[model samples]
Target chain A: MITYDDEVVCAPRAGTLYDVLELILDRGMVIDVFVRVSLVGIEILKVDARIVVASVDTYLRFAEACNRLDLEHDVRSKTVPEMFGSPVAKTVGRAGARRTARSLTDKVRDVLAPEHEEAAEAEARTRERAERPRSRPAARPRGEDDRPRSRPRRRTETEDE
Target chain B: MTAPTTTAPESAPESAPESAAAPKALYVYGIAPAGIRTPRSRGVDGAPVRLLTEAGLCAAVSAAPPRLRPRRRDLLAHQAVLDELAEQGPVLPMRFAVLSPRTDTLLTQLRSDAAHLTQQLDGVRGCVELNVKGTVVPGHFADLVRRDDRLRTLALQTRRRPDYEANVRLGEAIALGVRREARRAAREVVDRLAPLAVRTVQGATDDEQVLSASFLLRSADEARFREAVAERARACGDRLALSVTGPLPCYSFVDPRPASPAGR
Candidate 1:
């Protein structure tokens, strides 16, 4: 019974984290003073990574998904998400757009904010030496140091090292 | 939505800093100042990328045990960490699953690259990333079919015959027409957006995600960019849906993962 319309609850559009996500985790300053921790399961992210909805396939899929959404039965037209069982799959095109928009606004607030700077300082070396190199690069552009943030100050996380 | 403290909900309360542990590692998603929140979501492996600030700047990082690889939950985790960081300022995002072998090395790298890092940070100071996507809307086919006389006659003839084989052929033809239109529209999108971008990067495109692109713009450019997007939407609304997202932290322009002498 759930169709793409139900996506309103999950992703409103692809612009959510899906759009600028490449920018946030992949861009910016890499100070020579701090270490970047490697994340686990980052390689699988690339191969299985589903692109945001913006394709003809998506249009057809959307049409098909819409077709599945019984528009006829509403005594008083129901909210779109209510039509779909799972409204939050992180990949729904429309839902992603709304979420990404909201997230960007929040990022701006955080950046201009001089308040949280202290908290960021406290954990400067916190995750040092978590994991290391074994996988291919991310589907998104990432700064060079993909090593586990938990890596110690002495060596890289690659087992070979 | 925001990850400010370790106690934040997304990531499990991670173990302490593992500076000396062999298997221990730190996960750095992006850099920011010390004033922001610790994202509620953790990085890949569900290990939180917490804030680590020094010399006025902060790094969002997490603890890693060892031998990390890509997994479904982990990819989401990486995405989540950066998601939280974007709320701060321009985050120098790292690729997914990049692990540093040691803390000393990381700190040293950050220090060595401090000037460059600062410059990169400044580069995106008041800027954010915006991704404007344009997809071929199937509705355009109606117009295309009407405009093409050869196709119109063929369609009329097919309609008169009205057989399963005929329908399939008609549908196939329509699909082809749609593809041709989509490809043309894609070229047009790149042409239109390229001039407005301070930096432009192409993103991956699948059947569902078409016209994948990222643009870095100054904060003030938000208005002009939106105006351009609006104009594009009006111009191509029938054939494509042009949607713009952002005014977010500059995440695509940072890369100083200084390669070690041997790796380079």
Candidate 2:
């Protein structure tokens, strides 16, 4: 029932380095002989990628976002991370990051209640194809007009990649 | 950006070296076993990756001349080539932007390190790599809050006395609660899938997505494993967005060196 596009947005992920850093770096063959190429940016890359999830700021932000929801609706307000376009979850400014998350939480409701999203997606996809040809999973894959660029969204390399 | 690391899609005819006699550098991707299909495309660098097949081994190599530095295209080129090769068989993927002094050095690597390479290939022979990604599912937070009386009490109490700081605190608590739920689901996914794997490799993690481990499974177990993934997907639909990648050649599973006597 899931098309590549649906799967693109929802499928269980497959094997990629991003998915197996432990197996490759920690578990796989580490021959002491062959010079393990001292990659320049690898350590930093790994460090940045695995930023700890627990932060007071995060808690405050979560609290902030939760405040906007219906307490009795039983609809758990989705965290912004759910709105991520790519695997990378880089929240640069704390305040903006929290607001952006509303979209993702909002999406959960839309996904579960599909009729509207189907129409929205059809329209979104057409508009998407017209503008940005490379709209990746990157967030904010739009143009200068702030009109929501298409495919190739910007995945982070800053606090995230 | 194209999810598959595809930057440029070129018809990789000869792979870099054959185009040579010139000094243009070729970007290197990962290495796959010999006889597996060459990727349907080229390295993100736009160079063709020629296979220098040796005794049961093939290096998915491209030419890299001097003055070559890592560019986004080149890194993506490297990823794309390996992605292509991985579709067929096990690949010993090089890190992004690895350049040899010349094709001669790479060949020398293949020639001298032939035994090591073969052993590396054999290590991943009957295995496939599967990547699992877990992202936080926001909807789960409400479920958690409702289920946990303690959290519900806190939510009600916070609602009654709502203030800027209080709301932030409540939201933060809820966020923490949601993340905990997500992390738990992530663990469950790993534990359940681990049984089907020969070995597992974990990648670094970040906040939004848990780009965790790859399970190297027995080729036969792939189906069962996929079935399990579907089950997991359905079961944990709202807690975590679980996406599975590949029956790929053991790119992450293969060793870079020849096995030592002890390792053997």
Candidate 3:
């Protein structure tokens, strides 16, 4: 069973920037005369968001979660809530983090969070100063429960695979 | 996993030439029917946005920021301008980062393609785009194991031997079964929700995200659509987690065909 907060996911909210990122970048009318800016970071962002590599780590995590399940008892009799202290959900949740795949989701959460742009902008500035390989956002360790429940919404079917 | 190297630093040099140009470039937000109020929202680069009118249509534009980057502030600003325009009537939101080299070029395109653009705008006039996405919920692993003989046998076998390789196989099978169930739930979601919208457009999907769809919904039907989505969320909460974001400018429904063949 999904958490009550997860159930609240159905409520419609105004589209955040990440929610409509694909629409803003990919869709919409473009007159031939207009210059579509060749955005540099955006290509990497799109590529990062889509590549869900089925790595050994993900398989191992899944196996660990499955090992905890009570296969002997019929699952139909007892719902998901009774299963191994939410291990499967936690595994599935962390599955998004496979091989830096979490960056997009982290970015999405960062964007969707109600906190203002100054924090994100400042973080971006610091990252620029560091000139480090794209590091994870500083915003990650905050209580995950505090994240405004927004679904991961991609707006195109095109694949790089 | 490399950090975004080209963040704010690269933007400064790029905008230098744009600022030096004779006729300043205009960053376009969107095109709407003539005479909506100039959007009060701060535009890209914090420039004030104004509408450029021609051919009975007005385009919301701002002096292109000398150094344009897809910064969070600017992207939100672009959407804000279009959202304001969309509130009043139909608007063809421009793709982000579309810059008119000069005001005249934009005016010329608007004049030449006004008829086709207007027709396209009319198609989405009373409608709004609501995007619904559903991700796989491995919360149902127990249920999946119960239902699938292969998964159940593997789970039992792995529990008995409990070795590294055996555990991996059992886990991979469960993951596969979870995705299969989620995909089926995702399909059921679209089937139930599609009938309520004027048009449905499917988006990308992978193992984790089973469904991403945009429904072109009439403004009035927005509530009903949400209701249907809520019901689906409850029914499939075990397998899929669904969320809706919109009443947005109809981005998907527009640009289905070239606005003007000659312009292409």
Candidate 4:
């Protein structure tokens, strides 16, 4: 049984860049004569944007938050107030949810940007070394490395065309 | 985020030579009826926006930018120009980064496609696009975990063992529960709000954001529609957080390519 709250009703607000991004990028008219520039990094940006959701990291974060709950307390009585009563749960509430949700595009933008790629690569290397050897090593890093490398290759291909 | 630096070097080089030769390609923002006021807002790269009219239709355009990336400023500039046009009357917004190689070609296109373009403008007339995005709230997630015997059992098991693998499994189960509730709320929201809209276009939804939908509604109905959204938001507030952005130019409602006269 979900409860309703006044705070959850966000006013109709002006759209942010992420809010209107797909509309601007994918929707609207594109005439045949018009040249729609093969925007470099857009694919990478989009892929990275969607990747943040449903990832193992996000699952882990969710589990960690839930683990802090005092399960001995009557679950039926527990609601938003009780969740917010705990300092840990308060951090995982509204503000945190909005931040996590909206951060996808920003994260994508940061991850796809060339400067951030180097930093991300360094971080990934360190993370890989620190974590237990995983089965899907080839799959994860390949996607990241491919974007930066393929960008240059795409430019050359377009030039030749 | 870093200040809007110019796009990377590799992209700059290719576009540079082409820009040097010509006056500049026209970066089209949108199509409108001829005689609308020139947009005061800056175009992409802060270019001065002007209009090109032909066959009773006008395309709000600026000098073609040297390089076009989906930079934050440029994307906002594109929306701003269309928004300015949309205030005056109907506009058929061009997708971001659309450029005409030459002004002559653009004029020719406007002339040839006038009927189709005008029809598209009419389709969106008196309507605004309200995009509603709903994200998982996780407020009632504890209730879910408690209600489901499997989840409760898993929680107890994980608490007892407290190993990394157990924690991951427990976390994954909680994540699924959170998303399932949010997604359920998302469906109910869309169902409730769909009636108020003339048309509804669903956008991509991921695990965190269970709903991303654009609703096209008459300007007159906008208030009622918003009230309904607020109601739904309150009803599902604990499981999903809803945000509405609107009175926007009808970007999602617009056709990507207007049917050519021959096809029509």
Of candidate 3 chain B, the 10-residue stretch with the lowest lDDT total is B2-11
Q: How much is B173 displaced in model 3, in angstroms?
A: 1.4
lDDT of 4 at B98: 89
Per-residue lDDT of candidate 1, residues B1-264 (tens digit): 333333222222254445553333466666665578888775655564556666566667676534455443454566667656776665666665455444444555565555666677777776767776655444345445555666555566665665555555555565566566765766677787778778887766554345667788876776676666555544443344455665545555666454333221
Better of 1 and 4 by lDDT: 4
The sequence of per-residue lDDT tens digits that candidate 3 reaches over residues B1-264 is 222212232222233243423355778889999988889888887878889999999999887765778776777888888889899999888888888877666787888888988898899989999888777665566667767888888878888898888877876787788788889999999999999999999987887677889999998888788778767766666677676777788878888335453352
Query: How much does each candidate deviate at the interface, measured as C-alpha RMSD after superposition?
Result: 12.1, 8.8, 8.0, 9.2
Candidate 2 lDDT, B119-181, residue by residue in tens: 676777667777666666554454566677877777788778987677666766776777777
Candidate 1: which stretches are off by over 4 Å? A1-161, B1-23, B33-49, B53-57, B65-84, B160-166, B256-264
Question: For all candidates listed, what's the TM-score of chain B alone?
Answer: 0.74, 0.78, 0.89, 0.88
Model 4 chain A poorest 10 in a row by lDDT: A152-161
Decide which is better by TM-score, 1 or 2: 2
The CA lDDT of each predicted structure is 0.48, 0.52, 0.67, 0.67
Q: How well does candidate 1 score on lDDT at residue A126?
A: 30
Better of 1 and 4 by DockQ: 4
lDDT for B76 in candidate 1 is: 54
lDDT of 1 by residue, A2-65 (tens): 2222222212222344444444445544433333444444344333335233334333332322
lDDT: worst 10-residue window of model 1 chain B: B4-13
